[model samples]
Target: MAAEAKQSSYDGSHVENFEFYLQCSGEHESILHFLMKHLPEEFERIGADKSGLAVLGVGSGGGEVDVQMLSLMQSTLSALPITADIVEGSTELVAKFKGLVTKTDHLQKIPFTWHTMLSEEYMQKTKGRGDVKTFDFIHMIQMLYYVDDLTETIKFYHSLLNKNGRLMIIIESANSGWDTLWRTFSKELCNEILPVYRSSSDVLASLKSLGLKYEEHFIPNTFDITECFDPNSKTGQHLISFMTGRENFYQSFTPRVRADILNVLRSKCSTEKEGKVSFNSEMRCVFVYA
Candidate 1:
């Protein structure tokens, strides 16, 4: 079942896609800024309580960002202890992150409970086993694309938070290149079993429907994907694969569809700024309280 899930899922097994996307995108810098602005307040709250904080990281690929957040918390809170529940669907990713934990001196200090499973699978296991663990902070960083049901998953996680707990989600902003690309692909190819691509607007609407109050911040970014102008370039292909969640979008889609997609990407999805073909993305950060 795990093998089947990985095969059909666009994100769980796309380690290369994730890596390529990370290389091209300045998302980490934006996230770092967001964290620096907000984490101090979170640390103050946790410190005042004087109790160990609990964290849940969904789709925590390679633990790079997770460790960053923890490191920030440590520095800001003066080494307040934390118990983190790390949830990742990809076995390869989980192993890579575990390797980091073993080798990285800083990551060694924070305690972690690893769940090598999808968010949905983890939720099911918890429900079946009657586990009622509540986390003070939870995060799903740029990972909603893989989930089958966005609203339900958000609600479920919200329910698992203790009082004053927070759920932080990062996703592409509406009308951005990433948003345009994913919405088009989803309209063309989404199905009951496959992943559905959605933007931060979709998530915000869901929260609104649930009558939940939330906060949002936009992180502006640009990636120079000029190489993608040449459709045959390796970088172009890699960027397409990462954007479309396909191994080889040109080979997988019909010529007409692929051409249309390329046209959208080269035009509607990008702009020339400072003489460089830049993919403009506004990543939205949503914070929900329980």
Candidate 2:
């Protein structure tokens, strides 16, 4: 029998690897730029008639990006009281987020309710309840790939928005190397139990199918994947594992399988220039309105 393929979530033991991948890929810079350029105007419009703004961060890992977003909202609507609800599944990430909040004085002013649970669980608990909270702004960034049902999850989040509210989602774009990689090796690398092999294209399709109004923006980005080709580099291995959504993938897969993946990555997923490989890490930001 063949070995069972397993998918692992980022936790204390492996979250550092994910962070390293982020640093190498420079995805956060693009995300920050997009939010800075777009979120302030939206915040102004959303808080125009409201005394306060309610925000939700779904799968808000470590809260670094979340804080930046909240700060922008504060600056845009200086007098509007802002409260946030955070839903994250990782306990380690939740602790780190809490610690970050304590260190940042501005974030301290905003009241936050933390739920150390998955977005699905949070949705289940709040959906159909009479007193369920609604939000003026909600963000689900780079976290939809792990959800069980992309369409249903998007629908649930869309339903949580108040009038004129927006749900911002960031994910890998259709033109990204991730789309090529997953299309080529989903059976080997993707999570079979969940809809993990998803990209912004899928999100758009789901939005259109559900007849939801949304605006899409593409952010062009690249990843320095030179380390990924180095067989003996621990960082390289971690990057590969993070990209594939598999823990310790270099050690877990057979040598033949690993070689095939590497070949595909080099030939089909990245471009070579001056002996360095640059993987296309383009991202898309979608704003769904209620």
Candidate 3:
């Protein structure tokens, strides 16, 4: 029988690990480029004739992406007043986000409300209230993997959008390395108790099933995973842990399981050339309109 190792989502305790993962993943650059090239038109479509906007960031981590998106929105909308609500589960990440906001002078003009809670909790709290606040823009970036119910979560967020509002979701593409890894080893690596290992393909399927209209765009990205093949590398181990959503994966998983995972990662999820492995970290963004 396979050994049953403990599993948990990233939080304050694993903030460093998550940050390291982000640094190695090349995801930030891909997302930023996509936003810079495409978001102005999106903002124009959604913000036309509007003097004010309510924006929500779900699972916003460290606020780097949030700040960039908000800055673009401000520039595109020029004179519009924007209010941002951030929902993040990690205390450490929330503190980092707050600190980033404090240092950003342009963001100082915009009001931000922080909710240090998970998206599910925030959704429940809002739904339970006598008066529910609607939003003009909502972005859930690379965060749906932690949700309990993907379909229900999409439905809830969609319901919160005002007419002409936009709900943007970014996740791993169906053809990305993440999708390949999770599809191959979900039974071995994914936590059975918590939601994890989902990709953009799953999100699109849900949106279609719910009778929602959405547009999808692909962002191609690649990252070096040569370190991941080296068992002695601490950075490699952290990257592996992040990929598997299992802390200390190299130390915790059985030797057989670990070896199998490494084999799959190298041969299936990434390309190796000249002794270097490049992971196909492509991502997809889905835009749904209300």
Candidate 4:
């Protein structure tokens, strides 16, 4: 059973904490690989030259994408200057990312640094100091929602970018079939649903208003509900991840709503003959000039 959702300011630490969703996911790594390819295209558009680029990973949870991007950056810029700073918003994830770099074998490929701060606070501080033009690339991966103002964040990074620097953002695509189903059935399912800061459509419109253009791409993810009931093949990972998240936001719900949510989740996750169980996550790669 879970408690109600907590009614607190979005913690800076939730970035990496949220990565649990992907970590427990079976098809997450492949989507990550796809994001790398999409990212460079934007980097090139901003005239990065793919060499010696100083990159910032804003809200870089768990340093997963930062590590992958830095590796790709190293390969692309062997002769040029290549340094990366992964800025995390979560305390635990910041620690996890640092630990990962020191502990991971392949981390030696790229030179990198780590910092942790809320995107909004960091932007405010960076602005106050005029230390804005420090990065050639900044990635706000699934993080802008935590901040109260999207325009301020957009403007902040827009200023921080060096000449031809690029800003890339990644967020869940809310217009997918899974999202549709989640919204429709979630009320009946009694399963816990986490809140998203921006809907897919809203984010798209916001980016568009900034005069920044983006290419839409998706990394398909699935919660293989069928695997859940099979104790032999039981991936307790999904259940645990879902359950844990429910635990955090659980307190926000009333007992009656909570039970209804979980009940529907179990049935929806049941292995029926025509069990359609794939949630498509759309990742939009937004690119702007330096």
For each of the candidates, the C-alpha root-mean-square deviation to the true structure, in angstroms, is: 3.4, 3.4, 3.3, 5.5
- Output the worst ten-in-a-row residue range by lDDT, candidate 1: 1-10
On the 0 to 100 scale, the lDDT of residue 170 in model 1 is 88
- Lowest summed lDDT across 10 adjacent residues in model 4 is found at 1-10
Instruction: Encode model 3's per-residue lDDT on 1-290: one tens digit a residue.
Output: 01111112445546776667778877788899999999999888888888799999998878989999998998889889999999987777788899988998999999999998888899899989999889999999888877788999999999999878999999888967888888788777666643357788789889999999999999899889898888789888778877776778877789999898889889988999999999888888899989
Candidate No. with top lDDT: 3
Q: Write the per-residue lDDT of candidate 2 for residues 157-215, one digit (tens) a residue.
A: 99889988999999888857888888777777755544357788889999999999999
Among these predictions, the greatest TM-score belongs to 3
By summed lDDT, which 10 consecutive residues of candidate 3 come out lowest? 1-10
Give the C-alpha lDDT of model 4: 0.56
**lDDT (Cα atoms) of all candidates against the true structure:** 0.76, 0.82, 0.83, 0.56
Question: Which pairs of residues collide in candidate 3?
Answer: none
- Residue range 1-290, candidate 1, lDDT tens digits: 00012322434447667776777777787788888888778667645665677889998877778888887877787656878899987777788888988887876878889998888898888888766898888999877766778889999999888777888898888888877766766765554544566788889999998888788988788788777657679988887666665667677789888888777877888887675788867788888978
What is the TM-score (0 to 1) of candidate 4? 0.72
lDDT of 2 at 47: 83
| C-alpha RMSD in Å of predicted model 4 compared with the true structure | 5.5
- Quality of model 3 by C-alpha lDDT: 0.83
TM-scores for every predicted model: 0.89, 0.93, 0.94, 0.72
Q: Write the per-residue lDDT of candidate 4 for residues 85-151, one digit (tens) a residue.
A: 7766556677767877887666665577666666666666766774454788787766654456777
